[model samples]
Target: MAYDEGLAHRLGEALGALPGITAKKMFGGIAFLWNGNMLVGVIGDDLIARVGPEAQADALAQPGARVFDFTGRPMKGWVVVDGAAVSEDSALDDWIGRCREFVEAMPPK
Candidate 1:
């Protein structure tokens, strides 16, 4: 399926408004970089949020969310939520906040 560029643009704008955040294209998707760290991504109709394993349970508890597994195995510390869950600014911000918290803990690239 094709990714929603309009959605990506909207997301990118919000992420970009935050300090030390940038957006880039990769894996046929849009990745949001937080302080030079890969925090989240927009894949097709999904909003990929990086929530460390410690916070994985909380992230999973959110509606329409699941593990983010681009490869065969499900990746730890990351979750992908359905577009419906990201339709609102607050919801998107909540996901972004989780991603930022994890990304901030990582060493700069």
Candidate 2:
């Protein structure tokens, strides 16, 4: 299935101001990379966040969030937040910010 264009657009706007961020098409969706690291993306309207391993459990506990399972197995350090949960710009920003925090801390690739 194709990913949501609207969500992808929103993600672009959200991360537009950040330096070293780029958008790429992958996994049938649009991925936002920070400093060459995948930070967030939109998968079928859901928001995929790379919150890192240490914060995975906490991020998964949030409403409308779940494991980012693609190939019948869940990926560690990532979560997919339901699109509805991020309908508000503020909510979307929050998720993006969290993902950014984790990605920024990593050594640039």
Candidate 3:
């Protein structure tokens, strides 16, 4: 299935100012990377965020969040935010910021 083009476009605009960021097609969607590490992406209209293991639980507690189980097995540090949760620009920005925080702290790949 194809991802939401509108969501992908919003993400692009939100991340446009960040340095060392790149967008690639993956998992049949668009993945935004930070210094080679995946920060966030869109899959079938959902917002996939790399919140890291430390913040996984907290992130999951938010409304419209669930384990990112794209591979059939859940990825421990990632969560998929419902498209409804990110309908607003501020909401999307918040998710992107959370992803950026975790990805930026990691050693460059």
Evaluated against the true structure, the overall lDDT of model 1 is: 0.84
Query: In candidate 2, where is summed lDDT lowest over 10 consecutive residues?
Result: 100-109
Q: How does each model score on lDDT?
A: 0.84, 0.91, 0.92
* lDDT order of candidates, top first: 3, 2, 1
Cα lDDT tens digits, model 3, 7-89, are: 99999999899888889999999899988999999999899999999999999998899999999999988999999999999
- By summed lDDT, the worst window of 10 consecutive residues in model 1 runs over 1-10
Q: lDDT at 25 for candidate 1?
A: 87
lDDT, residue 29, model 2: 88
**TM-score for every candidate vs. truth?**
0.89, 0.96, 0.97
Give the winner by lDDT: 3
Say which candidate scores most in TM-score.
3
| Candidate 3 colliding pairs | none
Mind sharing the TM-score for model 1?
Answer: 0.89
Query: What lDDT tens digits, residue by residue, belong to model 2 across residues 4-109?
Result: 8998898898889889989999888889998899999988889899999999999999989999888889999999999999999999999998897788889888
lDDT of 3 at 66: 99
lDDT of 3 at 65: 98
Model 3's TM-score against the true structure: 0.97
TM-score, predicted candidate 2 vs. hidden true structure: 0.96
